[model samples]
Target: MKKYRAVVIDGKKLIRRGIAVMTLAVVAALGVLDIKIAAPKINVMPDSIGQSAVAESVPVIGAVSGTAEKLKSSAIAVVKKVVSFVLTFDPFDLHTAVAEELPLIKAVGYGYLARTANQSIAAYNPQNVDTGGGTAEPATPGTGQYPITEVDSGQGKALGKEKSKILIRNETDFGINIDEMLSSPLKFDMKGEEPKVLIVHTHTTECYSPEGASVYSADKSDRSLNADENMTAVGKAVKRVFEKKGIKVIHDATVHDNPSFNGSYENSRKTVEKYKAKYPGIAVVLDLHRDAFIYDDGSKAKFVTEIDGKKTAQLMLVVGTNGGGLDHPNWRENMKLALKLQNHISKKYPSLMRGVNLRKERFNGHVALGSMIIEVGSSGNTLSEAVRGAELAAAEISDFLNTLK
Candidate 1:
């Protein structure tokens, strides 16, 4: 009997060990398989941080000694740091790790210049990428396969090569700016009784700005701050909104102070997951965020609305375009929703938007069909304006979800 017991124990240990290996292997696989990490944009645009979401021939970071050595000295060192930042599987704290290594981003300046010079040389070489003719125009709205309003014809010099570098740097340095970059891109009208959809107010940008905790109002502690951590508050707010509607909501608003980048999303993703586990019936998941586009003069973008004149915030729809396994369809469906919302707000409230942006990237939108992101205002914008915008957007969202079938 004792021998049998010992054997059982040994078998259990092996199983546990195997589980550990498999778990790690899966994470690495996800990383290689392009497990998308939606980097927060400074201007409300959701950037794609890890193009590598799944495992591939690429060596597991810090796996072999030689690989570690190579990473310790390669340009990919930044890549590894970013991966570590997104994965959060490390001895180093994500924020502190990135903060401590701000130099890495600054160093990229030289690389950028060198690359720009090279590109210039290539352009002159005549065999390179064709800058030929005038720029192509965007397809008319509702003209595409989808039934949505048209995006502005504004294209071209706005997305120049140099601007691309700045954008890349911004994505690496900060995740995504919830307020400024992504103009509201949701469409739906919930004028009356409808199922209550929830928008989780998360901490994308660090709460404490240079001024104070105005736009920085969050509840982050020693523990990580994501939308989940503040589910209590989220639940309460959602409950408050849905009290009369006979609807219960799962809110994931963790007012933790962090930069509105990947960290915020990371924290929020876990929180939403936990909430979903608790309440499986959840249909819509809205990530309510503010932006951070401070002008050189310190003023933020503002829009005059029926409520009052406030800093204008941009809203974006971050949908998972990855149709790969685990990736969801109808990701573009959110685009339709976003456009409707943006148009409604524009008609009812002018200057409340820079415009809605369509990011090819996904910011966890694949989790559900009702998933979408909304950015209010930027760092230069007042917290009061942002709060007002949040409330307004909430109203619009609530109204819109009521219409969702």
Candidate 2:
């Protein structure tokens, strides 16, 4: 009898070891696949303190990496749908479906089932999912595609080499006011030690795509809130340009979108207000953000154009109006500044500026008449492109602001 018990114990031990080995093998396979979620990174600049440095690239994973990521995402979506359907039945409301301890058992069973389902779903779906662009809006030319309302067709210097016109589609229902904003020649007097321009980022974590990398992040949501590595790096580039031009700028490298995505605008507003209070000479408050343009066919849209023999990402000027139930009366002033800068950029860089975008949100533009949001580039662009774009923008903006009288 003792010999028989020992044999049974040995058999049980062998089964346990086999199960452990299988579990380890599955984990090893997943590690090899290196599946990533499909979140694209957005770019933005932050605070300053140096010359614009060239960006370095990291090698991207093989094609299998992306495929595994998509497969896992689809399986989760399917399981979520099934779970939602089961929850709608509300079995708890029916006494027929309940027993003495069935409620507790059902809760425990559902928890375990979800955990098991998540673990068992293999990252190998045969179906092809459009993971690239997803449902991102395309960079469709014409005014309706962007958030803008051209109030006035400002004077242009008769189009430089290969003149670019601001494309606008007047079919939208947005109100347009053609106010003569150019009252006097814009000029700025060199003030005391106070900063001339204040730069801040609401989405301080937005980062550009790395060169030679398939995606910016291994996870689907491609964003890094690192102030030194992401948007703040771009901001520093801009600050370097301004400093080179002898324009004093205050680049606030605060990460507003850190713990929460919401209330970023509010946080940035406080930052702007604080700086404005400290530096009364701050003439312009720039909220720097990077734009994202993804094509409808799940492909990233490229907004790069050759400027001065360097591949530079296009820059967009976003000016907000008080149309969206916001009490911003000085939006026209901001628009005027935007128009002037747009005209200057179009003339200087030709195709570098993607025209000025007018939006309904205040975007904290009420902070100052010179306040505006500058979108450097999209996720499809590299850090080098964005940094170069910011430098070019800073030069143009410095020239324009200096002429403010």
Candidate 3:
């Protein structure tokens, strides 16, 4: 039998090398690594105020082995970018490591930033520019199910008639690229014709984003990310898709309506119980949340989206593989459902996703066999994108559910 290999690295340190129990891969801010099985790089370097940004963070120096050079370099570079992301770089010196040692410390300089690093409000993209203070390589311009518009604004003005326009104010990190994400392993693994799958979305009370994520709380109202709309929109989307195929759908979107504190899932369970009574055929559940590590770019806003080429949305998803609560016998079953969805999407749509994030904590994944919650987008994510993602999810999962046994 052909064996698979799972390489584990912590920040910059190489730790383990073994095929994971499951082919499921997790995504995070630091170079697209997973959360749980991930190994943090041990900072053998002296700690100081300079490397303050990563004071608590493990420096992702490289990957596990030499054979994985490209992977390792990419990972380390990503970590360095996040830690070194500062608002005020001297344009020549970008090294923020406080009186510290950098194993491969390269030249540090200034890059365009709408926000600074000291604030801790959000994170920056790992990809940086070249020596000329420019973003360097050509970034894959934003694309969507819509069209793109040009703007003639300040920066656009600064361009001296350079064709430039904004994609509106409120935009999403990664618009709901269900078709795109479905092709990546980070989404629901759909196998053939979608079955009558029922997914339940759970909400978290303190849904916040990591400092350097694509989505951040520009306004306080975005503190919770796009939790509510994620579930509702996708729920409805799935209903529409499934219903057309003679499948029944029910969503307890009000599971944690206006919940107080962080126990939204607890309240959500109450509503879920009610759902159990109404839709006895329910099979899948998802708890939605944004990530804490990844951030976005403010330099001309590359991560922004345009609907129909106009202003639109992008989305991110996180899934908890944690036992959820007390070890429920049905826990594995829930995972099976999650795996099924993830695999399906990975094969169908590859670019639409950031990646599947297998988390450590459980929101309420043990209630049923097909129960799993998903985090759509963060506050930085546009309301429109969040809505779009849910709908895309409904469409993709609706197709996958019909394939379930």
Candidate 4:
């Protein structure tokens, strides 16, 4: 009225302020309503807001309550969306996605996948290790030497001392009559051209000293993955002798002692069973291995002898029995065959035979009538010497086996 410049009422600004005030009122109403719902019996309202004031605000509160319900619904929908996204995400897919852009991750991812695949395959085709059936025990200082009580007139004698006496290192309570066993006829009937002998390696990777090296590093294992350098090579030498003698033999180069040393006998047992199932006529199963002996002073023992002026490693025939509590009814028959072979081999080269080791463990010997573990040489010998020893032993063994019927 005093003619003050007519306060220009901006209508748009007034409308915006009105909307902001409405939103604040709605927020305050929701807070009060939440408190009322949480504490139904408590009076949390301010003293200034008497019964009449609350009655006046009832319509406004009711209008905003609907809006609050809509907002709660929207929030629940957003939570569901987040949960759905999380639940569907795959970590492997994520790894693949990230690996696509990163070169190092890509290489690592591929390697991981390959390793997992291999492990899965291995799980299905398990190669379990078991030492209960006997294993390659460490060599002692006087392994090949004849004991005072067990030595017979010709048994355990040197080449010039005795010709064909059977020496046995009996490690069991069971008594073995060498003469009786040698005289006993072999029970196996060798007929037809079917596979008569199955040669396998329980400790397939057992190796010997390198050529020209008398001593080896103690830290380095006396084992090799190369079939040409390990017991497989010795098996091949034996196979060759059998083949030359017109005897049908199966030389199974299956590696039983790789990726794991335990359960080697178990693994070879499976291999033997497979071959035996295929060739029911299989008579003899030879588990070829190299002996290992580390003395208290850490020096390895090498059981070597001279054969026709050639340095030859000595061989040992191991026969297993049921003393270990496993059922092996045919163990005695296996022992009989071993004794016959030992007698035969010793006659040709007396020093070549290191005596038959009779043990308690069945050693898969129950699989056949003529199953035995043949240790070609100790870790102290060379590959060449072991091969020669196996050839010499197998030649005589095959000859004797050929005569059995």
Candidate 5:
């Protein structure tokens, strides 16, 4: 009977030893796989029993190493199978199961489930997803697809003669007497060879649509840091026109909207002030920008018109007033200048001008006597179109400036 009891005890020891070896193998396999798991605490046999089992079972070091290698290979295979199962598991089905099983937990519902469902559904439906970052539908071919209301240069003339020459999209209560403002001529008493015009871009990174591309990227940003690709290029085009007409012009290609979109006006104000301090003769400070218009259907508007047989983006003169409670006394003068330029450009190209947008924000217009914001083209217009528009406007603008003296 004692011999029978010893055999049973030995069998129990062997089982304990096998359990320890299996546990060790699993822990090592998890480490190899780099998977994190909270292993349950197991009550192992005493050290003496474990040592005896190891000594009797794994007598040679070589045998013990060989057994360990086999266990490791088996553990690796088991881990790979578990990983594969987890990857293939349907998260939506699991969520549904949980919801059905625990109806009482409805008060603390899984809000993320709806988003997950949308993502899953979107993954299978490529047509519904705009993976190319462009508009859902391709844009209509050709420029000037959208019709613009041409300024009736004769309608408002009977009401207010000069004001009639330019349509004012007024957003302020400040009354503008166009005739009174135009009566006082814009004078730039130029000293020899000094810059009379200063062209700068507050939103310097504003860009146009891709050239010759019918489809516009909806998710792609309309801003770029590249000077050649952004508003700086437009400013350069305007400067070139001015210089060709023997007008000294300064183009401050400082980037004001980068790093942060906020405080762009403030940063640009500093830039204008710095240049103004350096060049006191700078009479006209033109803040150039590209306009952005999005329709309810997610299509961008292109304010484009053909001029001299070339495609040109339309120009808008934005004149800001002190209606926003800022001290801008020279706003009337700025309006007068904008009117003169708009009227002159309209005479040449009836549909070139998008009219003058009068707003409440000062937009640093009070910095100089002839400060105004000129929006050239929009996100839907190409850079070449915008450049052509700027050049045309600048030519007429230079002619007007030449008459100033």
Candidate 6:
């Protein structure tokens, strides 16, 4: 009986291999025949209007495992290019060939063509595709999702262009005591037993490019508020990090800058007020956002660094002042918190942060002493890098908060 079972399994394996060979033969035949084809023209142009300019180049170094991946990717890309090039040759139209060719071959070829056409149509639909940076499947709206597990904590060495520049400007109503903030001890008393961190985004629609991705769809922008796509996804990363560190956090994934870009701050302010009223113990309010700085040449400033052999986006701390007659006196206190956290992050993960920016306008910093806007990365940084920056920021923040009395 055991021998009989082995014989049966061998027979099945032979049959499966035969089918695979037959499928390959059919595909080869289709390619040789060139039933139908379309010639596509390629064109490249400079951006006339000012848009976020992508970095001309970046240093992409991977570990030993990355070599294998690069080879496999290269082979696959070459095959795809060859196939695409062949499909452009119209040796014979499908209908014409079917009408004038061998009866059996024609029928089989027509059936294959029909099936391929249907599959192509379904796959090409814009609404069905998931263009997010990572392999995690997108979550259905209204349902919470935490798909990312491992953080990219690789310590990347500084390349020539990878270092982010720190710009200091005079944009404050009063003199900033940077020396005092740097010297101040990290100490905070727990206000209440509930969650003390409130994570929010004024421009919830701000998004980053997918890692190693180049294509963009007509219907969707790289900057979206989709839960698993943009800054909301980054917020989710931060929330998970804080939760893991035993820090209670509430991430508001509400889209305030949707449908229109105006008055987003007003909408986000309401969200902060509502959350503050509910959770009086909230001591830290981080308005997480990604920056988009287009250079005069229309290229975006790339703030990238390699950590532990992984490429991660560097972070920028933007502490606002109560200038422009905004009536925000507690701005100095907020700056103190920002400077302290910045110092901590710089000490621990030096490559993970750019310098701190002290902006002039009050960007909803009056909500809390610990409130400040953090730009994880710019438009040039991929979503993967942005999320890694968020994770590192969460770690530094948790360390600072735990030190408080």
Model 5 scores a TM of 0.60
Clashes of each: 60, 21, 98, 4, 2, 11
Using lDDT as the measure, the top candidate is 4
Count of backbone collisions within predicted model 3: 98
RMSD of each: 21.1, 24.1, 20.1, 26.5, 24.0, 21.7
Instruction: Kindly list the per-residue Cα lDDT of model 4 for residues 299-369, writing each as its tens digit.
Output: 56677887799888888888888776667888889999888888777767777788678877777888899
Q: Rate the local accuracy (lDDT) of all candidates.
A: 0.39, 0.57, 0.38, 0.67, 0.65, 0.59
lDDT of 6 by residue, 122-152 (tens): 1233443211111111111121221211222
* Model 1: ten consecutive residues of lowest lDDT: 132-141
Rank the candidate models, highest TM-score first: 4, 5, 2, 6, 3, 1
Off by over 4 Å in 1: 1-196, 202-247, 255-264, 294-320, 323-328
Give, for candidate 3, the lowest lDDT window spanning 10 residues: 129-138
* Clash-forming residue pairs, model 4: 129-262, 129-263, 130-263, 139-293
Output the lDDT of residue 160, model 2.
38
Query: Once superposed on the true structure, which residue ranges of model 6 sit more than 4 Å away at CA?
Result: 1-170, 185-188, 214-220
Predicted candidate 5 versus true structure: per-residue lDDT over 1-405, tens digit per residue:
010000113565455446545654665755577543333344333466675576456443222333545444545545544433443332235564354333222212454111010112222333432111111112222233332221222223323544346577786798877667667676444445678788888778888777775556444566788888989999988988999988998999998876655456777888888988998888789999886654423446677776678888888888877765667887888898888877777677666777687876677888888888888887778899889988888999888787765
Off by over 4 Å in 5: 1-164, 187-192
Error at 161, model 6, angstroms? 17
lDDT of 2: 0.57
Model 3 spans with C-alpha error above 4 angstroms: 1-201, 204-219, 223-234, 255-259, 288-317, 321-325
Question: Model 6, 247: alpha-carbon shift in Å?
Answer: 0.8
Instruction: Please give each candidate's TM-score.
Output: 0.43, 0.57, 0.43, 0.63, 0.60, 0.57
